[model samples]
Target: MRRRFVIEAVMVATYGHLLVPSRPIDYVVPYSTILELYDMRDGSDPVMDNADDDAHVRGKISELIAFFEDPLNRKKIEKAMQMPWRESSPLLLSDEIQFTVVHAVDNASYGEFFDPIETELLLTGSKLNVPLLSDQFEFQDRLIEAEVPVQVYDIEDFEFAVEEGISTVDAGLRGE
Candidate 1:
């Protein structure tokens, strides 16, 4: 039997939707190897075991959403967070040079703000030696749908949207 895992990450980059001044973010990728990815559990609190790393990622996602509260200053914050990192190159050198894009949002309405960024990342991936040729490509098409309680953020008057359930994945995790 094939075991599945859900992973969530935060990223900041420029695209059609963002106002401007956003920077390419730097995130420490977890589950680097396929073996590590396969070992994750689907219990109520997957990240609770790795509190430090998970907390940092959640904080960044909150900060990113908060930045949206002020459209004028959005780009400035993104630019400040941008750091230089080695990105995949055009040459088909080796597997290490390839990359795939995984999308994540701290809140429910991800399709709103994330679509443009996802498009930009897809274009970038097209130039690399990655294996994301089709939307159904294994490993590349793993979409982890999750929901954190609305109280996770300091913002008030929040609304949540839910995606249609799929027969494959289970996302019944409780949040405090």
Candidate 2:
């Protein structure tokens, strides 16, 4: 069965609709998802558990809505959208992926390394190579690459005017 994942990549945010027919809900992607992608490219399973979208992405969506709805952070958000690692989308997995988590290795007792996230773009069977923010982690300086693409989805893909803006109340997780 196909699994859902979040890949944090540097991508431009699109609204009102997507090119794909599957993505129907509003969601957000964090910066850590890319590490899983890197691991996947390196022939590692990264995670064996199902890690679909969750509260964190929703929280980010809420934050984005609140930030943009105010008409104050609009420009800043818009600019951030264009920059890499600023915006993200969910990735549709092809039976091989199953993950979504913050890039952390605080499990010193476990002795592990953590790092990237991506769910912003989707191009199944297609490979992707992105620059890493090496400074974020100690070992990242050595691992700076990503590959393969999955189904991509935008958080807000419904018709909404910039002036109209989406309110946290109106743009609820369920779009209720």
Candidate 3:
């Protein structure tokens, strides 16, 4: 029998989508099986000359919460969450999983985020080695130096075409 290993941790980067498109429902929904950690930093500081970046972050979070709370969207979210584990290998087993949220604005901070966690699987494994962000290479090097039994997977690479949908209400407000 195949060993069933529960997802021990889900390390999510800021602004990264945890949901994917569901063609049948024509909506995006959250993953049902695994818990997600939004690795967010306290955005107390102003991001630009006058922009309140923290408020923007909070607004985004509120929008997501509203999406999840809608009765019309619940079924789709549930279906999406269950589909992967039922059709394929189980990503998470029945256990208490560790969910860590690390906040970093730059590479040095991102490297510091990994110092404490014992990461076994790093999603988008191929991208981990690629220096997409200033600190990515250094972060990868740290993972290597620490010998943290890490496995990488490029699961999201397959869902590259899905466009982020904007709500009709928002569109109307924008006079689109």
What order do you get sorting by TM-score, best first?
A: 3, 1, 2
Q: Quickly count the clashes in candidate 2.
A: 25
Candidate 3 C-alpha lDDT tens digits along 1-176 = 11111121222222333232232111111132122323322235432244565556545554544444456444444444453321221222113211111121122323444632222123211112211111245555765575433322222431332233332244332221
Model 1, global lDDT: 0.26
Per residue, candidate 2 scores C-alpha lDDT tens digits across 48-156 of 2434323333333443334333453334434445644443232322233222222221222212222212122221101222111111232322222332222222234
> Alpha carbon lDDT of residue 28, candidate 3?
14
Residue 136, candidate 2: Cα error in Å is 28
Sorting all predicted structures by lDDT, with the top scorer first, yields 3, 2, 1
Candidate 1, residues 94-175, lDDT tens digits: the string is 2221112222122224443334333333322322212111222222332222221111110110111011222212323222
For all predictions, the C-alpha RMSD in Å is: 18.5, 18.3, 15.4
Better of 2 and 3 by lDDT: 3
47, model 2: CA deviation in Å?
A: 15
Q: Residue 167 lDDT in model 3?
A: 27
**Which residue pairs collide, candidate 3?**
6-92, 6-93, 7-92, 32-81
**lDDT values for all models:** 0.26, 0.29, 0.30
TM-scores, one per candidate: 0.23, 0.20, 0.30
Q: Which portions of model 3 show Cα errors greater than 4 Å?
A: 1-51, 79-139, 146-176
